[model samples]
Each structure stands twice: as structure tokens, then as C-alpha cells.
Target: MLPFGRVAIIGLGLIGSSVARAVRATMPTVRLTGHDADPAVRDTALRIDLVDDVAETPGAAVIDADLVILCVPVRAIAAVGTEIAPDLPAEAVISDVGSCKAEVARSLAAALPDHAIVPAHPVAGTERSGPEAGFATLFRHRWCILTPVDGTAEPAVERVAEFWRRLGATVERMTPDHHDRVLAITSHLPHLIAYTIVGTASDLEQVTESEVIKYSAGGFRDFTRIAASDPTMWRDVFLTNREAVLEMLGRFSEDLATLQRAIRWGKGDELFDLFTRTRAVRRSIVEQGQDDAAADFGRTHD
Candidate 1:
């Protein structure tokens, strides 16, 4: 069990609700509370017994709580942090599950006091949004990155890691800048590309649009599934992580042009070599257990 006396989760969205449910499954004795800006969500959470108690706002949720998790959108991190900053318990540890870490850390630092405020990004989620979409096994066997700011207490960081570990996540430490840049390429860029291609396909003429949807097999269908992810959440991610994503996109465009040229010129050797090299990378990832063909379908469940 975590050393935390109380765990308060703000914003009962998909990620928040998933964590809340997972905590209950993992630690039944821990005192848990829920808060959300929307009253309907709070009421639903209460009806479903997703939390022991429900609060109306961020301050009410964190009062007397040892661990407070901000599980709202990335854009609202600062505002939520500011609202609960003054009322935060003196020894409490504040953390977040926002996708973008650097922006969240900068905002929370200005709002909270000299307490431990660890910015975390649990690399697990689903295309679904809202409270009903959450599940108890969302974080199981997934990676959770903690990016502790300078001056954050070591004990507080360890306690936070313990909490995540109890819920079956592999905890890893990273600098906020590094986390943001890496995710920009891996997560953010992929989502952006998915949304863009899906949008393009939708904008095709009526006949072509129907054909595209009808013929969508593994690749295009996979993009569609990713593109179906929460729009507001993704909009906030792109807006906040603009610089890193833009830089990555530029490089991606250059490589895409090369691949396009190769395909147009029937350069079979270049295509074969590129595919072989990329296949090796996939093999290395599989050997390290980062991915498995058997589990590819399982990722969609989260």
C-alpha cells in the first residue's frame, strides 16, 4: 500500500476514472475521493461507487488528502493547480497524468507551494472518453513515466512510484523535456498523422469516400481507430506540445518524400532495404518485450 493517507483524483474522465477503478481493485483500504468540473460526471461516479466521496471542485477534493492527482485535460492543468494550490495539504504530493509533462510542470510549479509535485504521464489510454469508458485494468503492465521537477522531495517521488506500482505499472523516471520530445515523436505525431489522414479520407468526394471506408483494411482502419480518440484531449496535446511536434513533423515529411520518390520510380532495392531495417527494429522491440504480435489486439482494449 502507498504511504498516502488519502488519494484524491480530480476530473473523472476516462483516464481519471480508469485510475480510480484500478486503485479500488488494487488497494481496497485506501481512502479515495473524486472531483470533476461536470456535475453529471460526479453524480455518475457516485452512483457507480467509483470513489468513496465526491467533491465539487479541485480544492474540496485535495483538502486533507496526501496524494492529489490532476487527471483533466493538459490545457486545464494550470487552472486546476492554481485553484487547489493554496488549499493543498502542507505535506501532500500533487501529481498529474497529463500526456504533456513539460507544460504541466511549468504550470503547476507556479500554482503550488514547495511541496512535491510530480508530473506523470501514464502511457496508456483508449479512444474512448468520459467516465463510463474507464476500466480497472487500464494501467496493467503499462509504462508510467514520472518527471519530478527540481527540489521535489525524494520520499514523495518514491511514494508516488509505489502507488503506481501497486496498480501494476512499470515506473520509469525521465526529465520533463525529454519526456515531451520523445512522446512528440512516438505518441503525439502518430495521433496527428492519424487524424490528418482520416480527415483527408472523409473529405473525399461522396463516391470515393464510401469506397475508402469500404476498403479500409488493416492500415487505414488502424488509423481510423486512433483518429477516433478524444478530440479535446488531442487538441490540447498538439497545442501545448507544438514545438516538439512541429520539429518531428518536419523530419517525418522529409523521409516521407524519399519513400514516395522511391515508390514512384520503382526503386525496389531501396524499398526492400528500408523495410528490412525497420523490421529489425521491430524484432529488437519484440525481444525486449516492449511489443508482441499476440498483444497488439490487447492494446485496443485500453
Candidate 2:
């Protein structure tokens, strides 16, 4: 049986549009409804025929949906939940794509007290935004983490997991708190570092802006790509997951200080050992199929 017959997506940005496209590709018969806060986005969604129907409001989109997925920023999850609560079907399973789970779970529970909320984070995306930036294969080989509250019904959680599985994602379940902590180190901290590095490069008085751009190396280019991610989304992610992010940031700061001391004192062995261990981590990620080992990260030098 299909996990969901009618799916509604709130927020027609990259993730939302990608879900609509993935559903259409994998489950042709399933109905799709989508809505976005921006009228321009809604118009773009219609122009692209992104869904079976583009509703004018959040509530309208979920009125007949079997599953509703919120793809907005983390800070906006609660307001969207409250907006759609009145129209959600009694048995509809609610899920979201927000990175922070603990605050999102709490917000969702508070907004829709009687609903079966299954918060999810699909660990896939690019430094792109808007409806036209989405592709049907975005979730292929990606991990989708589901963090349902303690008392959520098993069937509802399974349905959400099955939904992600059908979209070509491997599903894993974890507690909201644990999910936040793990993602803090794996995802959030990396983005934070990227933004800081890119910002620092831009603010250097020793180099002219044009000079910085002209001499950009591979590492700085990659950091700029990470920093180019949606500001609103990252802002909310940092704020919503502040505790875990801060904890991970503190650990990172201490490690960075150690590296600084090693470089200053000519501790070549210490630096070499740390670099070797970290290089193994990159290799492991590639071995697990999480990244490409191709030369220059699969970039075409031509």
C-alpha cells in the first residue's frame, strides 16, 4: 500500500519543491498539494506545474492531505504548524525538514497537540534555493532522520519512514536531543565555520576585495559555496539549535587553539598526527558512499 495517498508540502522552496518532484517521480498516482508564504514562489510553482494543486494558504493545502511536510525555516515551523492545524485531517501524519529536532518537536507538539507529529531531517541539499532549483533525485542515497516524540504511534512513524524510503533515502530514528547533538557536530558546526572563514576573508584589510576574489584557491572556493546557503535558514538553524551548536563550537575552539599552539611552537609531529587522523575521516566518508573520492571532488578542470 502507498504510505500516503495525498501529500501536502508547505513552503515551495528548494526542499519543498524537491519533495513534490520526488513524489511525482516515485509515486505517480499520489496526489500533491503545495503552498508557500511568498506569492511569487506560489506563482513560480504553478508555472513549473510543480504540484497537482498549489493552494493559496497553508491550511488549504493540508485540508485533504494524508501527510503534510513543512519545509520552512526552523523558527517558522511552529507558526506554520499552528496555521495548518485546523485544516489537517484527523489521521494525517505531520513531518518537517528542519535540521533542529528538539525545538521543532516542541514547537510542533505545542502547535498541534492532537496530531501525530514525526519530525524529519533529510540530510541532503545544495547551496541553492527557490522552486526551480529542486530536482527529483536530490534525496537519492541520502539519510533521512526521523525524531518522533516518545508517545507517537508506531504506525505513524513507520509511515513517515516508508515515505522517505520510497524517495530513495535511508531512514534512521533517533531521539530529538540526540539528533540535535549529532547534527550540531556533523552539519551545523561545519556551516558555522564556513561562514566565519568566508566572512573573515572578505573583511581582511590587507587584501583588496578584487584581489581576494582573484586569488581564491580551492579551499576558499568551497567555503564560499557553503557560506552561500540561505541566510534565513542558517540563521534559524543556529538559533534553534544554539545549545548543541554552542557545545560543539566550544570543543572546536579548544581543538583549534591546540593546533595554533602546535604551529607556533614548530610541533611538526603533533600537526602531522592530527592531519593523518582527519584524512582518515575523509577517506571513511568516501568509503561509506557519503562523498565522492574523484580528483578535486569530481570537478572538471577543463
Candidate 3:
């Protein structure tokens, strides 16, 4: 269990609520309070016993909190940090669950108090959002990357790392720039590709639509699942990590074009070679235990 005295989570969405539930389940002695911009979300969290107390505002929730975790969309994180900054107690450890680390870390450090701001990203979530979609084990066995910026206290980072470790996650420390670039390829690009393919399919005429749905198992179905992730969350991710994502997308498009040409020319050898190389990448991921063998070439999580 974490040794935190008081922990407050802002934004009672899926990630926020999940953190609250995990903390309560694992560290029952710690005081937990929660608040969300949406009053309905706060009420729902209270009703579900996800938090020990519900605060009327971010300031009220973070008051005297040894750990303050922001679980809001990336775009809203800075504003929320500012709102809670004045109420933050000295030596408090502030952190976030934002996907894009560099921008979030920079913004929060600028807006929040000069306490310990340890930016983290938990690489686990479902397509669902909102308080009702959260679960205590959502972060179990997941990778939680902590990107503590310059001037961040070592003890504060360790405390946040321990907190995630207690929640059944493997914690790793990374630089914000490295985290942004890696996730741009591993996560952001994939999500963007999924959304594009699904949007293109939806724009097709009524003629082949029925067949598209019927034969979706050919690979389109997986894209549909990624496309269904929370729109607001994804929108914020892209906007916040624009540079890294664009750089990755340029390379991805070139590779995709090469594959398209190989298919058009009926070059079986080229296709086979490309597939074999990609398969090795999958094997490497499984060997590293980043994904389970049952997840199909590390394309899906669980």
C-alpha cells in the first residue's frame, strides 16, 4: 500500500475513478477525496463509493492532499492545475494520467505550485469513458511511465512510482521528450490510422456497406474498436502531441504507400518479406512481455 496521507483525484472520469477505486482497495488507510467539473460525475462517484469524500471544487479537493492526481483530458489539465495550485499544500506531489507527457508536464509545471509535479501515463484503458466505466483493476499489470521534469523532487517521483506499483503496475521513469516520441508511434499513430480507416469505410456508398460489415473480421473490426475510443480524449491527445504525431505519420504514410504498391503489382515476395519482418517485431514484444501471446501480434491489449 502507498504511504500517502491524503490523496485527491480531480476529474471523475474513467481513469480518475479507476485510480480512486484502486487506491481505496489497496490503501484503505489513506484519505481519498474526488471532484469533477461535471457535478453529475461527482454525484455518481459518491453514489458508487468510489471516493471517501466529494469536493465542490478542485481547490477544495486538493487542499492538504499529499498527492493530487489529475485525470482530465490533456487540454483541460493546465486549467485544472491552475485552479488547484493555490490550494496545494507545500511538499505535495502532483501528477497526471495524461497520454501526451511533454506538453502536459510543461503546462502543469507552469500553472501549478512549485511542488513536486510528477507527470505519468498509465498505458491501460478501455474504449469506454466516464465514472461508470472505471474498475479497480484497470491498471493491473499495466505500464505506468513517470516523466518528471527538471526541478522535480526525487522523493516525490519515488512516492508516485510506489503508488502506481501498489496498484499492480510496473513503473518506469522516462524523459518527457522520449515518452512523447515513443507514444506518438506506438499509440497515437495507430489510433489515428484506425479513425481514418473507419471514417473512410463509413463514407462508402450503400452498395458495398452490407458486405463491409459482414466481412469486417478480415481486419476492419479491430480498427472499429480503436475508432470507438473517447473522442474528446483522442482529440486532446493529437492536439497536444502534434509535432511527434505528425513526424511519425509522415513515415507511416510512406511505408503504407510502399505496401499499397506491392499489393497493386501482385508482388507476393515483397508482401511476404514485409509481413515476416513485422511478425518478428511482434515476437520481440511478446518476448519482452509488453503484451501477451494471446493478444495477436501485440495489436490488441488483452
Question: Among these predicted structures, which one has the highest lDDT?
Answer: 2
Candidate 3 clash pair list:
none
Question: What is the C-alpha lDDT profile of model 2 across 49-164, one tens digit per residue?
Answer: 99999999999999999999999999999999988888889989999999999999998999988999999999999999999999999999999999998789999999999999
Taking all chains together, each candidate's TM-score versus the true structure is 0.94, 0.99, 0.94
lDDT (0 to 1) per candidate = 0.90, 0.94, 0.90
Give one digit per residue, the lDDT tens place, for model 3 in 108-218: 888974778999999999889999999999999889999998988788888899999988899998999999999999899999999999888878886477787899978
Q: Pairs clashing in candidate 1?
A: none
Candidate 1, superposed: residue stretches over 4 Å from native: 295-302
Q: Considering summed lDDT, which 10 consecutive residues are worst modelled in model 3?
A: 293-302
Clashes of 3: 0
Which numbered prediction scores highest in TM-score against the true structure? 2
**Winner on lDDT (2 vs 3):** 2
* Residues 193-286 of candidate 1: C-alpha lDDT, one tens digit per residue: 9999999988877648778888887468879989999998999999999999999999999999999999999999999999999989978877
* Native-referenced Cα lDDT, model 3: 0.90
Error of 1 at 190 (Å): 0.4
